[model samples]
Target: MRTRPVLKATEPWEKLVWWPKVMYEEGRYRLWYEAVPPDHWDPEIGPKLAWPNPVFAGLLCYAESEDGFTWTKPELGIGSWDGSNETNISLGRETVGPMGLHGASPFMDPDAPPEARYKMFWYGDATPDVVKAARRERPDAIDPRTTDESHVRAMYVGTSPDGLNWIVQDKPAVVFSSDTLQVVEWDALRKQYVWYGRGWSWGRRTITRAETTDFSRWPLPQDVLTASPINPEQTDLYTNGKTRYPGDPTTHLMFPTLYDRATDQTTIGMATSVDGVAWNWTPGNPVLPVGSPEGVDAGSMFVGIGLVPLPGDRIGLPYAGYSYPHKFPANLADSGFSWCTWTRGRLAGVHAQTEGEFRTPPVRLAGSGLRVNCRVQSGGSLRVGVTDEEWSEIPGLGVSDCQPITGDQLDATVRWSGGSKLPVDRAVSLHFSLRTASVFGFEILDER
Candidate 1:
């Protein structure tokens, strides 16, 4: 993976910019990130005001890019900072109350009306009245940790037309402090909104999930992904960057920031799931490992929510990097946004060092042809054939008749001596044979 810094802390209100939520729409890349004013963590005042305290929470800022690499923080003139409205601040404490936006995850709601095309799920200070009502009516939904006479924090749902101006719901959606990136997506299959956030498991941070049919009402999040026995006691998963693979929405992917309390450091980890609730860690994790001791991302890193499709058939994953430990004083820490990319549809692969073969389960061949993303090294090759439901090889489509696939290609056509055409709309299984090669994934193509 290749990584490069895209945005730096240049503006006055962007001293600790992080928690990037990016999107690609209308042929442009739009980014919304959390920006903290430098003074929020002042040496003297910082000691008194606890981190994440409502007194000085971070602001939600905006930026855009024609190409995912170069970004511009256009002055939106929407929110004021130090009596100046010429800032790129998209949402600030003034709009979302004293407790500013925390882990604001935004997505385009395809099912919503034009005026409410964009929606966000975030945690912030809940009004006193809302807190009181929640305690009285739905005490089970409130997080006990946030109970304080001064104020209470809760998750909120907000909508926007253009993603810049937002209409936040007056009441809290889920009365809990999901302090990590609150990822929400419209689960088209279930016809509901699914949310993934931070939850406590075994006294450590874990990824939680919740579903709701209505955007305004959400149940208390339940722990879905947690640390296993393999993990050290002091290690936990934080910031659930849950997202669907752009190339295949049916596959759920997460780039959870693995937090090590023992070292006070964090690194990005990969997880995969067929259903959003159940998850498994991807092998050889910490995919985007930390840098050298003195490097920018040495202390911690968190992957953004979206996987951006870039030029050159690559997919970019945006992330924020800190130069100091996660618990380091914000005033003394340096952070910025960067993105790393992988060859499109090649984030992970199935490898075979020796001669190996496998057959997929029966699937309806809706497309006319099969294309595969794979790489075959020298002295290695791959062959794909088709089989009937009963494991019988189709005539003229056996392994021997298959054309050998060699070299590297993102979408190589699988062909046979007889014909490359497939039995469209027929239930069949794909048989793959490999020798010292790797198969990333396969796609059904409409073109024969």
Candidate 2:
């Protein structure tokens, strides 16, 4: 048996930072992480500042390293569209909107019409009410840990002709609200502009995919990755936010979220996708585990969206380090810091030998109640065909959502089928077909 590799947290960086983004640029690695003062960032209420808690805003810090391993914090100065902080907003720059600015995802356009080569999209609110709400909510009025949604923010975009000069767009790019961990990439293989972000639902998060011919406008939303709540093996696969790995489908690697329930620790994990949307987990999906159990980063760490590739082709990731005491007083917020990590070599991928096998049950008699359970092992849409004694596809039964649950154990139940309220009990085979899971064939279960 192969031994479980031990990739412990090494030196040169602190832990428990929130929203770590990595990127590769100019034959070197650059990282951007979010950090606030430890005492100011109330753990009970998270990065969001509660009432009278003395909340300090978030900042985008810069760090550069020769090797991806060791990093040196450099001065990029405060937020700037240009090298100078003239056009940028300062700390505590509050807008009357949802929430204040958080970490931003950076994208470089080498072929950007010779005008602008860099763009950044971030989560924030320009609404006045949100800004007021941010100031109103306090530990003095209510419990700091309460979940309040009075102030919701939208995702906004900014552009830079060079890394130094940036200009915030007059209008927002996406209208949805939630703290965003975004990755903007131009895929040469698919020739599409891919934006990866997570949609919050069901006390968890799911990966959402949207494509655009141009970066200016986006179409309707679709679920590229759904949340797998009941699956224990997939417990760590929480947020589907950013992907820092370089390369297209074949060598593409992504940095995702992994929250351990055993200790309520949040950190980044690793996974890979082929077509830039659908993802498959490599062995031990939680690649970068929690920080040291007894160190500065011992609490939890979220992700940021920039990954700089270093000279030797190593990858540098900038992340925020957070420290929230498990057992703490009610009003005190969690503490946080900024740090980074670098990775080398090609990440792992999921192995599929024979694809997958899907089968729909036999036909049933008319007016008989029916429920279908088509479980898919791999992550893909499962289609079941219900024949009307003569064999035909039932309209609604053909709906997709029965995506495989990692190992394919998803069950779907439907009412009457065969164009009537009836039970299927005929000698018809249950033929299962899969779309977008993998390059494989389905199996046939002969009618009973």
By lDDT, who's the top model here? 1
The residue ranges of model 1 lying beyond 4 angstroms of the native Cα positions read 43-56, 144-151
Full-model lDDT for every candidate: 0.83, 0.47
Reference-based TM-score of each model: 0.94, 0.56
Q: For candidate 1, lDDT tens digit of each residue in 374-428?
A: 9999999999888888988888888888899999999898899967577775788
Residue 357, candidate 2: Cα error in Å is 21
- Backbone clashes in model 1: 0
Report lDDT (Cα) of residue 49, candidate 2.
57
lDDT of 2 at 303: 50
- lDDT value for model 1: 0.83
